[model samples]
Structures are given as structure tokens and as C-alpha cells.
Target: MRRIYHRFPQQIDLDFELARPFRDVLSCIARLHNTHTTSKGSGGLVKERMIIQVADGRTQFLDLDDLIPLSEKTSEAVDFRVDFQRTLLTPEKRLPVAENVFYLRIVDKGPVTECYAAKESPHGDMDAMDLRTFLKGACE
Candidate 1:
């Protein structure tokens, strides 16, 4: 099993600990496209897409070619949305149809320190003291 802790600039940090390996996540994404194609019983072009949402709110879309390289052990982040699409043969013509969508957020905790030490006080003001003071007391 592995654990992942993703920290945001202002938002709360997310902690994810799962039994599945990192490669399994990528495989699952690939399976989405496979299942859709098999179930549809179509030989049309199936596209496996991924949309990565950065902390700054920027989005980057990727195809299977782009995602294959990212399935390495060195990948520290897996925060993205996945979509499965295929060409559909309607009564009139062929059209692109979205089969499914999925969201994932898993960051490796390999670089996180065992203990975090705070030197300066946190900026937030609570009652009278800052957030650091409040946390220090609460942790103790």
C-alpha cells in the first residue's frame, strides 16, 4: 500500500492512502476506453482523454499518447479528469459521443517529511492568536 498527500497553496491538503499501485490507476483509465469500445460493438475510433486541472485552475487536455509516458513510478501527481469518447453512428450520420467521465487526485507522499516544523506564525488571525499558536496548542 502507498499513501499520498497533496498540498494546495490555500486550499486544504488532501490525504489519499490506497492499496492499489500507481500503475493500476493508469490502467483503470485505459480500461474505460476499452470497455466503452467493447460494449458499443463498434470499430469506430475510440479516444481516451484526460483533463488535468492544476491548482491555479488551468486545464490541459491529453490523449492516450500523452498519458502513456506519465504512467511512470516517478510520477508524483495524478490529479486529473478522464473522459471516454467514441464515434457513434446515428440514423443520419456519425457523431462523436462521450461515453464516460472520471476524476482522479492522487499524489505520492515519497517526499513528505516525517515531522513538519513551523518557524514563523501562520498568517490567519483567530480570536486573538494566529493559526500557528492555535495549532501548536491543539496538537499538544
Candidate 2:
């Protein structure tokens, strides 16, 4: 007898640096927050999370609902990262295709002696960046 397997969700990920701060790296979450992702949901970023390394060598995190104020001055930050994720349908013609996981990432780090803002923007200039996407789903 022959056995068959059913549909299974596929995990996919694409990682690359924008090479630009996203307007350039500031090595701090505050500068990142003030940049493009300033918006949420329909206005801007669909989803996001941040991890920052402070002067004491500790880590701090922020979510979409909790934003760090620019006036707080995180200029001394040594490292930072941004994770954005959403779900979309895979392009496979196979049956039972549904929205799956997709992610966008940006990360930067340097010696504690360097300044973060002085670095180049990798993926943060919102208006200057570009992405190629295809329309897929049962409807299209």
C-alpha cells in the first residue's frame, strides 16, 4: 500500500543588510525608533521588536506598544537589532496553501568605544529602500 503525506506549513527566512544606518546605524534603539518604524499597523511597520545593549553590558527590549523617547539619549548603546515579521501565502501551486511566516531583519554592533550614529544606514531610510514582492493567495 502507498502512503501519502498531507499539507505542512513551511518556514522561510531571508536575511540581508540594507548597508545604507538604515539611514545608517546609530548603535542604539532610540535612533532606530525615531527613524522609519515610527508608525505602526496601517500607518507604517506591520510588526516589530527591538533589542539594545546598554553601557553596562545589559540588554533592553521594546515592543510596538512601548516606544523609547528620543530625548532619553541612548547614544552610548553598543549594539542593536530589529526584527519584523508577518504572514503571507507561499507561491506553491500545491493544495492548502495559507499565509506563512516572513521576516525582515537589521542588526549592527561595534566596539563600545565607537559612536553608533556615525555609521552608514543599512536598511533604515524607509523612503530610499526597496523590496520585490509577488501577489499570491487563493484569491489572486
Candidate 3:
């Protein structure tokens, strides 16, 4: 089975850079859970884990334990992308909002060189420069 390293909540945006190599592929697991309560059960829950190739600019979704080999001789930086879907549950008569809970996790990597979780805002700017700046000053 694949291992999870990082997790993020639903509807929240996340940005990070991978600058290291591991024995296997880098990945992220996204989980979604509905908060609505029904007489039948609690709510709906869904999970999607994608094996990501950090060096590639496009998004590549993979199955569980799927391995994407990395060239040890090559030196390149990797970027991560996580896309979430909207929910279909709503209270009484309010509009249905995409408010599911989610999380992100990386497989087997020992330690991440850098990771950043963008602030949750209705109009927050999650830009590349802002992420770089946040990572730069995170530990300081």
C-alpha cells in the first residue's frame, strides 16, 4: 500500500514545491467527506489519491501504489497540483456548497524540503511568488 505524508482540507487551496529525490514516486492523497446528516446514515465520503510527477507541469493522476520512475541522474524541480470537486449536500434549504473535508499525503518520502498551505480565503491570491515567499520565511 502507498503511504501518505501531507493532508489538506476541502475547498482549501494548496501550493508546494518538491526539491528532493526518493526511492519511489511522489504522491498526494485527497479525501472528501460530507457533513450532512440523514436518517439513513451520517453522510457521504469519497477519497481520491493521485500519484503526481513533480517535474511535469501538467497534472497526472495515478492509482494507488502506482510507481512513476524518476531519473536519479537528472536534476529537476517538481511542482504539485491538487484539484477538488464540489459537494452535493446541503442543510435544510440552503444552497449546496462545496464544503467537504479533505487531506493530502505524500508517499514514503523521508522529509519534505518545502511545503506550504495557502490561507483559506474567498478572495485570497495563491500565486507562485507568494508561495515561494511563504516557504522562504516559514521556518525563520
Candidate 4:
């Protein structure tokens, strides 16, 4: 499981962070798209969303309801939302090496097997991100 932190109150300032595999996954999404800014600021998207699978192997999209505070959740389970604009920060190309950023997408069924898809189809065909590669090189 991956842990992501996000700001509360949609009207508040935008911010968030991802850990391990999830962070890696998001980084790939960002790199392919060349994403760098959002309504919140230059940082990646701030919304929270997660990829889920049903017993039948069908994929489900779950959004973290801002009305409910995440701290209220018990040990049973947890829920979150996804904000592509905030999650995928723009990479600094000025450095000797480019930094891995973040990206947003809607996978068909499995988050792992799916290829990098653009945030929006009408926007055009952008590079698809491979979560595995992001996980390997994200950390300096």
C-alpha cells in the first residue's frame, strides 16, 4: 500500500506527497506529460484518488470525499482523492539531471499493467509513464 498526504478543504492551499511505489507511479505520469503546474501553484495536483479492483478483477475509481476528514477513518480501511494537476510537479530541467515529477491518468483495470495515458484524451497523445521505472530512479 502507498501513503499520500493532501491538504484539506478544497478552498485551502494545494499540497500533497506520495511514498514509495505510489510516488514512483505518479512520477512516471508526470515525466511523460511534462506536467509542472496547477491551480494551487507550480507544485503538482492536490486532489486525492485511488485505483481499486473488485473481486471480479474489474477496476474501480474511488475519490476521497472532501466532506469527510481522513483522520476519522479507523483501522478497518482508508480512502483518499486524486488531483493530477497538483501531484505531478514540473521537473527542473536546469539541473545536470532531470528530476522525476508526477502525472495523472485513468487506468482501465489494473494500475500496474496499464501504460502511460494522457490526463485528457482531447489534449493529445503524450508519453506514457511506467511506474516501475519511476520507482527505480525517483530517489537521488
Candidate 5:
């Protein structure tokens, strides 16, 4: 059987850069904090141990051990993105441009798993940048 990282109670802090234009980061935060999940059958019929409460929403089953390493990796990568975006957008500060954007993402590199964002706003067309690459790189 394959081992999957189950959802677990976690406190996460996400940050984005604000050098010029602004960006939306709320939706991704909401999604990350409110999703429900459970882990079962990985070890062949063992009872679950941990639960995740979404503060303002539902409950979920998750694993604490898996989150520790993942969270560490995520935190390091996020800081890198913040620095990159700030340097890139510094010259383009303008209205209708989101100055800062940040959110949480859940990534499962397993069969039937997926990538999700907490909040998002439409990133308008503009050369000199690709938002998807920035976000995806941070998460991956």
C-alpha cells in the first residue's frame, strides 16, 4: 500500500511581496483553513489519531508528523518568493495592480491528489511576469 500524508491540525502563516502592484491572497487562505479531510486504510485498517478543526468551519482527520517537514519546506520557499516578487515588481507600482498577494496551498503529489489555493483574484495580462510560475514554484 502507498503512504499518503493525511490532513492534520496546523497553523500556517503565508506572506507575499508588495513592491508595486497589489494581488489577492484571501481566497487561498480561506480554502486552506477550511477544507475537511480524513486518513484511512494506509496502514491497513488502523484507527485515526489526530483531528483538524478549521476554526470557523468543519473538522478533519490528519497526521501531525507529516505536516512538520512539509511546513518547514513551505516556509523556506515562501520567503524566497517574497523576495523575488518584490524585486521584480518594484518599478511597476500602480493602482489596479495588487501590491501584495499571499495564500496557503495544499499539494499532494499522489494519485488522485490535487493542488488547491485558499484565495485568488484574476491576474490581468502583463508582460515581464508570470504569476502561475511564482505560486507553483513556491508550493512545489
Candidate 6:
């Protein structure tokens, strides 16, 4: 297979200062069109939200959440949340990949690497990271 050389940047740096303003904007967007159904006693209200289901073929999503200011992520910010379930899960029952706690989404033709040294093996650091739910306690 042709290689994706690490001539470009491998990691992205996020400024902690830029988070609050972005959070305000995401909050406004989440409250726009979603209809509030009913209150869940103490859990607040449950509303059908607009979620952005991103198909991560290139595996750039390893940093997509960090690209946004995800410090105060909630179901209310579903519009800005990104779901990376590429292989998808059956509604019948929650499934596990390879019977492991970590869901193996893909073999990762091009995986995450800190640097491309002379002897840097592509598979040295396993690309299989624990699935992080975009929304808190709302991952299905």
C-alpha cells in the first residue's frame, strides 16, 4: 500500500482560552430547532436533538472533538457533537468488537503516529483507542 508520510503535522494544538466563546455559540445552536418533549424529573428535559454523524474514513476524528472546545459538552450541545460510530451498532443489543472492551472500528490503513522516525513502525502505537461518547451518558 502507498504510505501517508508524516511530512505534515501529526497533532493539533488547542487553546484553552478559546473554549468559552465557542461553548456559548454551540449552546445557542442546540436550542434553536429541537422540540422539548417532557422533563425527566431531575435529569432535566429530553428533546430530539440534531446530531452530526460524521463518517470518519480518513481517521481525522482522532482530534475532531478537540478541534472544538469540548470542555463543557452535553446533550444540549448535540449539534456540535460528532459521533464516530463508523462500523455502527445494532439497536437490538450493544455489541463489542473482538470481545474486547474497546470497539475495533477499523484496521486503520493509516493510523496515529507521534513522529515518522527512520524505524517508526506504523502499527507501533495501536490506533484502537477507547470510544469516547460525544455526549455525556447519551452514547448508544
Q: Which candidate number has the best lDDT?
A: 1
Q: Tell me how candidate 3 scores on lDDT.
A: 0.32
- Candidate 3 residue spans exceeding 4 A from truth: 1-67, 70-76, 89-96, 99-112, 119-140
Candidate lDDT values, in order = 0.37, 0.27, 0.32, 0.28, 0.26, 0.24
Per-model TM-score on C-alpha atoms: 0.37, 0.25, 0.28, 0.20, 0.23, 0.17
Model 1 lDDT per residue over 25-124, tens place: 4454344432333234365444433233221223443444444444552255554443334455555676665433333355545433121212122332
Runs of candidate 1 exceeding 4 Å displacement: 1-18, 31-35, 38-59, 86-88, 95-100, 109-140
Which residues of candidate 2, in runs, are more than 4 Å off?
1-57, 64-67, 89-140
| Local error of candidate 4 at residue 98 (angstroms) | 18
Report the C-alpha lDDT of model 5 over 83-125, residue by residue, as the tens digit: 1121122234412222233233333332222323222233423
Measured on C-alpha atoms, candidate 6 has an lDDT of 0.24
RMSD, each candidate, Å?
A: 15.3, 16.8, 11.1, 14.3, 20.0, 17.0
Predicted structure 4: lDDT: 0.28
* Per-residue lDDT of model 4, residues 13-40, tens digit only: 2222333333343334333332333334
Ranking by TM-score: 1, 3, 2, 5, 4, 6
- In angstroms, the error of model 6 at 31 is 1.2
Superposed Cα deviation of residue 5, candidate 5 (Å):
17
Better of 1 and 3 by lDDT: 1
lDDT-better candidate, 3 vs 4: 3
Q: Runs in model 5 with CA error above 4 Å? A: 1-68, 71-98, 107-109, 118-129, 135-140
After superposition of all CA atoms, the RMSD between model 4 and the true structure is 14.3
Evaluate model 2: give its lDDT. 0.27
Q: Could you give candidate 3's per-residue lDDT for residues 3-122 as a string of tens digits? A: 322323344345454443333223111111111233222354322222222313233423322333332322222333333223334454323333212223233335443443433334
Clashes of 3: 10
